[model samples]
Target: MNSYMKHGFAVAALSAACNAAFAADDITVIKIGSAAPTTGAIANLGKENENGARLAVEDVNRRGLVINGKKIKLELDAVDDQADPRQGTQVAQRLVDDGVVAVVGHLNSGVSIAASRIYHDAQILQISPDSTNPKFTQQGFNTTYRLVATDAQQSPVLAHYALETLKAKKVAIVDDSTAYGQGLADQFSSAVKSGGATVVAREATNDKTIDFKGVITKIKGQSPDVIFYGGMDATAGPFIKQVAQLGLNAKVLGGDGTCSDEVIALAGPAVDRLVCSIAGLPLSRMKAGPAFEKEYQQRFGMPVQIYAPYAYDAVMVIVDAMKKSGSTDHAKILAAASATDYQGLTGQIQFDDKGDVRSPRLTLYGYKDGKKTLLTTMTP
Candidate 1:
C-alpha cells in the first residue's frame, strides 16, 4: 500500500476507536436486582417474574434512558432465593453488595419478608411484584413496596365469594405453612367465621408436602362444602388431585399462589374444581395488558404466569422514580418512589402509607375446558 493510503487508514481507525471510547464513557450503568426461586417446584413462576424485569430493562434501554442529562444503561442482576427464607436473606445481601440501587423481586411472601430487612438496612428500594402477606409492608420499612393487594384485602373477597356466590355452609381450610399460605389461611378463616360459615376443619402442612393423602383422607371425613388451600400451585395441584382421588367432591378454592397455569398442568382434570383468586386484575382487564402480553410472549416465548405484569411494572416504577428524582442516588430515588403515581401496565400505580397498592383489584378465576377463565374482578 502507498504511504498516503496507509496514513489515511490509520487516521480512520484512530478516529473510530476514540468515538467508541467516548460513547462508552458517556453512558452510566445502573444495576437493578431481581430475586426469585429460579429452581425447584415453583421455578416457572419465579422465572416469569425475572423475565418481566428483564423485559423492562430492555425496553428502557431501547427507549434511551437519560437521567440528569447523562445517558444511562440499565442492567438486571437476577438471583435465585430458592423460595427459602435463609437463601432470600443471603440473596438480599448479595444484591446490596453488588451495588444495585433497587430490586423488583422475591416472589414468595415468606422470602420477601425474610429479605426485607436487608434491603431496608441498605436503603435499597425493594418493590415486590407478588408478595401478598400484610406483614411485608406493615414492617414499617420505607424502602419496601409491593405491587399487589395484601391477603388482608384478598381473603375477605374470597370469603364472601365462598359464602354468597358458592353458598358454602361448611368449609375446610388447609395451608402450606409459609407466611403467604398461613397468613392467607388465617385471614380466610377469620373472614369465614365472620361470614357465618362453619369452619369444619383447618389443616397445616408445610410447603414441600407433596403427598397429601393423609390430609385428604382427614378432610374427606369432614364432608365440607368447600376446601380452601392456601399455597402455591406446586403443592395445591397435587393436593387437589389427591382430594379428588379420595372422592372429596367439595369445590376447591385457592389464593393467588395456586391461581396459576402450573396448577392446571399439575392438577389436570381436577383443576376444573378449583376457584382461585388473584390479588390483582386479570390481564384482560389491565390498561396495557394486551399489548404487554403480546410483547411478552414474543420476547420470552412463554405465556405470562401470575406475576410477570406486576414485575414488569415494578421495574418500570423504579425507573420512573429514577427519572423523577433526576438522579441515581438511592435515597432520592426512594423518595420519588414513595410518591409514585404512574400508569403502569397493571393499573394505576400508587402506594398507600404501608407501601401497598392503593385501591387494589382482586380477580376470581375458575377453570373452563382446562383453561383458566376469569370469573370476576372486584376491588376489596
Candidate 2:
C-alpha cells in the first residue's frame, strides 16, 4: 500500500474505535416520577419538594451513580396531583402508564394514602418524604416507603407539649378531614386526654375553606386553652388569620403540614407565638443544611422549604437502593429501599417493619418576624 492508503486505514480504525466506546457507554433511562401538587395553593410545598428531588436526580446523573459497574444517569418524571386524592390516583396511574420504575412523592397524606394502592397493585416502588398518616404502610402493600416520621411519633409529641410544657388544661382538635389531618388529630386528642387534659371540642373543615370564622368562634366559646389544627398551610394559613381576627386569644398549633412561612405571612403579626410540630431538624440547623441550602438557593434562586431536604434524601435513598440491589428490577429495588440504613441530610434513616421512619427527629417551632424559630427538638 502507498503511504496515503496506510494513513487512511489508520484514520478509519480510530473512528471505529471511537464508535465502539460510545456504544459501550450507551444510556439506559429509567423514568422515576414524583406526584405532588405542582399548582394551586400548595404548589410552593410541592415545588420545593420536587425541586429537591430534581436536584438529587441531577447530582446522581452528573456524578455518575454506579449501577452494575456502569455509570447510570438518574431521570426524574414529575407530575402534578394538585394535592387532591383523586388526582393523586390519576398521577400514579399515569406514572405506571409512562413506565416509571419508581416514584418519590404525593405531598398530601390523603393523596399518598390514595395513590399507594395504585403503586402497590402495579408493584412499583414509592417513597414519600412528607405524608405522615400511619395507614400508608399498615395495608401490607410492601411498596410504600417514607423518609419522615409517622403521625404516631409526631402527634404525641405535640400533645405532650400542649399539656405538659405549656400547661394547657383544656384543648380542642380540628382537622381538614384528610387521612393525615384526621389521623394526627385523633392521636393528638388521645394523647392530650391521656396526659390529663380535657378534650373540649373537635371540628372538621374541608380543604377549600377560606373563612374558618364559625369554627373559630365556636372553639373560642368552648373555652379551650389551645386548638390543634391537623392540615396544610393553605387552610391553616387563613385559619390562623381568621382566628386571630375573630379575637380568639388561644394559640394555634399544627403538624408538619401547617409549618410554613406562608402561614406566618398569612397570619401577619397574628403568627406570633403560633406553634407547630415538624419532623427532622430545620434547614438552618442541620449540619448538611447550610451547604445544601446555599447550592439550592444558587441553582433555583429561592430559599429551601421545610420538606425539600427530606425529599432530596428520598432521592438519595432510592439511588442507593438501586446500587445495592444489583438490578433495577422493581421488586428487588423496592426490597432494597426497605432495607436502607442511610445517614441522610436530615438524620439517620432506618425504616421499621411497617416501612415508617423509626426514631426520626422532631422540632417544635413558632413563627416570629415572618420566619420559623425552632423552639426545641424532642431528641431521642
TM-score on alpha carbons, each prediction: 0.99, 0.93
lDDT of each residue in 156-221, candidate 1, tens digit only: 988998999989999999999999999999999999999999999999999999999998888888
| Candidate 2 lDDT over residue span 1-380, tens digit each | 99999999999999999998896677677778888899998899999989999988888888776678665767899999999999999989999999887899988889999999999999888899898888888889888888887888899989888987789999988898989889999989988989999988999998887789888888888888888998888888888888778887888889998898778777778777579988777887778899999989998899886899988998888877888898777778888987889888888888888888877888899877767888998753
Once superposed on the true structure, which residue ranges of model 2 sit more than 4 Å away at CA? 1-25
Kindly report the root-mean-square deviation of model 1 from the true structure over all alpha carbons.
Answer: 0.8
Runs in model 1 deviating more than 4 A are none
- What residue pairs clash in candidate 1, if any at all? none
Task: Give candidate 2's TM-score.
Answer: 0.93
lDDT of 2 at 73: 67
Q: State the lDDT at 128 in candidate 1.
A: 96
CA lDDT of 76 in candidate 2?
Answer: 91
